[model samples]
Target: MKNALSRGLLLSTAIVGSLSLYSLTTKVAVVTADADNAGLKLPAGFGALVVAETGARARHLAVTPQGNIYVKLNRPNKEGKGILVLHEGPTGKATITGGFGSYGGTGVYANAGYLYATSDEEVFRYKLNSKGEVTNPTQPEKIVTGLINRHQHESKSITLDKEGNIYVNIGAYSNSCQVKDRQKGSLGMPNCPILDSAGGIWQFRADKLNQTYGTGTRYATGLRNVVGLDWNSQTNQLYVMQHGRDQLHDIFPELYDTKQSAELPAECLYALKKGDNAGWPYMYYDNTQHKRMMAPEYGGDGKKVSPGNYIEPAAAYPAHTAPNALLFYTGTMFPEKYRNGAFIAFHGSWNRAPEPQKGYYVVFQPFKDGKPSGDWEVFADNFAGSSEKVATGRADHKPCGLAQGADGSLYVSDDKKGTIYRIVYNKK
Candidate 1:
């Protein structure tokens, strides 16, 4: 009887040992695969690799110090989980290690040993272990909840500052905050009620758990919808890319022609402070005019200028580009030209139909003294698969999020193809 018991214990130990051995072997075999860079075009010194064919609608991503990549999906995977954790093998290849979190979201950021993510209606966080992986997948602390999600521009993008504060973007549901939203010639609301709880960035405590909307402070207001935002540590300021109001011609064809509608309102990048207002619903910045113009909903004829003392954008880009992600590069892997600059991922535009669709690439804006110094130029291109595909709005991949790894490599996430591309500068 004693021998039988000993034999059973020995068999159990062997099973455990074999499982561990298999895990170790698998990790070792995860070498970096050669990513096809044929489709992506870049500058002379930079190259990209398709690290992982994630097969999930990847939105935003966070890279840990230990080199683990955490991706937030716009929708849940087969197991109903929205977060995917990836580990890089010795050969620089990344493989999915685990999946967690139930509700899909558009924001994922890591700071102070915690991985912060947001669903459309709430913000949640998971504690990270020494290896940069989540310690508890099934349980996460709900940092903020009860956010309004009205389906139109409902993505809750997030950013974290060095001072332990988290900023969340609660996009306005209506395009122009019109009286009868989106209706032709609909008058603008004098005082947009959505500004009370939405259409702004809310600041919350990074360490606090289970807080609600009332607990957060409206950091900045009058932003129509901001999907691309980041904290520039160098300037110690918050920066955001505001998606300008759409349908200028459709709403007021008398004031604006189709060509003007496709190109009048410029996508803007604003460097924000605590009480800053970008002047939405009331005014829209026209890069061509070089001034903030009053919207047609506000009784403007496309040539009327705004009277409000609104702040101007740090830099402005072409209209309908749909800038989706912003990152201020602080890494040393790239040349001096790229360091301290801002990288913007344009998710491409659908409204520029009569005209050719544009902005399916990543752009670099040079900065000096914490402000834009030179013209913003395309850093990476050809994500639309081809110029013909771009013109017809049939893009193969759209760059949605940008992240920097510990080794100074840049990572871009595509929601359309569920792919992650890593850009590295091999000039040296």
Candidate 2:
């Protein structure tokens, strides 16, 4: 009947390589709450909850050093994976302690004690312990893997740098490279040899987990997409945001105007180093003359500009609110004006079509001594449940990943509902 140690643990591949079924047995504290939901709102000492809701498409999050909370879900409807842990208490309650996915696009991180994860091509690591859990999640290793998923900007998103290196964005499956991507003459990719292998951001060597995209190193390039990235230990550099690039009226319909393609390019933010370039297709970033223009496929069209190069943007927004995630608040809960500031998450915008849909939530910006000092707030709103409906940039909840905890609180992720908020600063 199938049970002799489950058929010798499935024909014994050395008992499945000596079994380590992604260890997970956490539950030291429990406290569920969901009297309907619709919560969150901070400052005034701060607080917001709902640590784990449906639990299936939660996106990014990493915390550990014994505060537990790993998240990274997004398999949805066909589900089967791991990494969801949780486990936090000291009164703020949270506990799931079971989940460890890897093998395809979700992005979870944990650093130092090692946990790392990813999958729209590959990256993995596991062997955490000393309370952060996962002592050997089914033995993952593969640090990199063929990463080139042509599914609309693909999802890689990774971070780490303090000398350990390991940045990974790789987006650009065609859009401004057009030539058929957005259709028209479908002509584009002029000098875009796919930027030496997909748009930008590569760097590797976080202990070399299993590297393979030809090994790594191409630290920066014309980036037409970067679902937000981080590493700003007070200016150690390497920040990113860029998502700009969309059909501005189906590629220069005689020079924009669908209401100026909802607002015209701009939606950048950069800091990169080590060979930086930051100009895609040709150049964009012109939030009312902030500068760097010329990008109607390389020819001066929307008011000229761009000549001899690019690289400029420490700020600029309003376009397709799609900035996925970026963090940099050294924690301590909040106030001190939010320490190193820089939240960001915005999974909102359906082209701003004629004027309506705009970024669904999260936004902070306030870096002080390392740059960007103030201007830009709205840290978490109703996540598009309805702020007067324009619907179809869609979102019953769409904030898309950002994490930090180990007392510094704040962990939001919502690949369209599968929630996992947690804000906190309770100071009661």
Candidate 3:
């Protein structure tokens, strides 16, 4: 019995030590020099490569089964209104196939034998040929139009499930539901008047084109900004990453410090269903308590929980990581453990002061039996050079979109540098 107890203690110590070592290596690291952008030097069996560099402020991406890549850019005037297509030829190089842009925003996806792209006010579809190239590019059928465009949080992220149901993210224009707008201590709408229009996810039919603003039903509500959204095939559900509201310290100095501000309100990842309400203006994710917390403007301290009202996120991240893209990994290139995990592109933080900034990298959160089982790890990094002090205020690239190629490779887009990277595991 004594030997058994000793054996147990020794095993426990070994397991803890192993986990500590992995955490130290995988946790977010600070980078400051331009050399860091040469692409991360991974473990012996893995590698990363930069596939495309068009300087187009690329935001999101969709890759067809035949290995062609489609990138969506945020610059309206330069990139125009259609989607940018890049072809990977036999030489393993990437070249622009074509540029199509009638309108511009940050939403783009490939679904149901068509390329569905969304701008500030509308969604359009283009037919594709067998080669994964856009055919009949001259014609774009408007799937949805006439959405709100108030110049704040105007991007409408689009996604589709297996059931042919389409979903669009309509972010709230108001910051913190302010009555006077961006003012501290101001009251939100008594009944959240914005619910009638924005602050929700609306559902539409994928086959229905040119549907007006009121054509769809409100599928979910209370999301401030959800630029990153995707459908999880294994779960048959839609997942969204909300870009948490900023300036917590600036808004409530009495309750928050600069460091806390950088790390307080958790950026949230939610699984949505019809009629789901994720409290946005009235509540925010508290990273410390790991729960939905009431907003200060809604009459509560930082400690007060917003119960029975807001849907809790499946997972929470540090404040201001600015998760701009979400993708479920269904690839076999990496270890078997990553088969059902999720990858998030955090564009990094801007308001977290008095310290080195974090994020601007890719993180992989593993799942087991549909539940998060391990700590999130940095799958890719060194995007903004290699110095903490330098990267705090300046960055060469901020990750905005994530996509997995049909060949099981990964694609990442950077809005800051307007670059696209294709990361594949090199069997060495």
Top candidate, metric TM-score? 1
After superposition, which runs of candidate 1 have C-alpha atoms over 4 Å from their true positions?
Answer: 1-38
Number of the top lDDT candidate: 1
Weakest 10 consecutive residues of candidate 1 by summed lDDT: 1-10
Q: What would the per-residue lDDT of candidate 2 be over residues 87-177, giving only the tens digit for each residue?
A: 7664345677576564446677787778777777777878787666887777777778788888878888889887887788988888688
- Runs of candidate 2 exceeding 4 Å displacement: 1-28, 38-60, 65-87, 90-108, 115-129, 133-167, 170-199, 208-216, 219-223, 228-253, 259-295, 298-346, 350-354, 358-382, 389-428
Q: Please, what are the lDDT tens digits per residue for candidate 3 over residues 1-428?
A: 00011112222434322222122322221111123234663444455556678777788888876557888777653546446888865323478877887666888888758888888888888887766777866688888888887878888888888987788889888778778777755666777787778888888888887787678888999988888888888888888999888777777778777777778788888988788999878888887777788787787577888765678788888777789998888866556777878989998887676656778888888887666667888888777766562356587888899988654567888988777776655441
Q: Considering TM-score, which of the candidate structures 2 and 3 is the better prediction for this target?
A: 3
- Please state every model's RMSD to the true fold in angstroms: 9.2, 17.9, 10.7
Output the worst ten-in-a-row residue range by lDDT, candidate 2.
Answer: 1-10
Candidate 1 RMSD to the real structure: 9.2
**Shift in Å, residue 253, candidate 3:** 2.0
Between candidates 1 and 3, which one is better according to TM-score? 1
**lDDT of model number 1:** 0.85
